[model samples]
Target: MSRYDYRVRRKLFNRGQESSHKDFNSFERKYNQRHRIQRASRFLLILIALIVLIGIAVFAAKADNIKKKSAPLESEKELAHTKNPL
Candidate 1:
């Protein structure tokens, strides 16, 4: 090939490589941004789920306590019967 033709071919090849590199960089940036958002959302979802579970556990514990308090023990019932004698 002639020297001029060789230089032109080299320039065209370099341009093609640069464009491809730029495209790849753009795609990588978009993918990374999407991945970061997904990760953040996943973390948030897990946190919310944990909070909900904790709330449910606390509510269950409170309900159990209420149920226990609403009923008199056998000893207390007997003591009441003795006191009233009715």
Candidate 2:
């Protein structure tokens, strides 16, 4: 090829390389942003699940306490009735 044609081809090749590099940088930025958002959402979901599990545990403990409190009263009533000969 002539020197002029060689220079023109080199310039076009450089321009194409620059455009492709910019495209790659744009794609990388978007991919990183999407990955960050997904990580944050997963953390939030795990936090919410832990809160719900703690709430359920507390409720179950309270119910068990209520049952314990009522059990003695029921046993006393049974004992009192059984003591009398009918």
Top-lDDT candidate index: 1
lDDT of each: 0.84, 0.82
Please state the error at residue 4 of candidate 1 in Å. 48
**lDDT score at residue 1, model 1, on the 0-100 scale:** 65
Candidate 2, 1-86: lDDT as tens digits: 65664343434456435554568778999999999999999999999999999999999999877844435577789998999899
Provide the lDDT at 5 for model 2. Answer: 47
RMSD of 2: 11.4
Q: Give Cα distance to truth, residue 10, candidate 1, Å.
A: 30
TM-score of 1: 0.53
Q: For residues 1-86, what per-residue lDDT tens digits would candidate 1 score against the true structure?
A: 65664343434456435554568778999999999999999999999999999999999999877844568889999999899957
19, model 2: CA deviation in Å?
A: 8.7
Consecutive 10-residue window with the lowest summed lDDT within model 2: 6-15
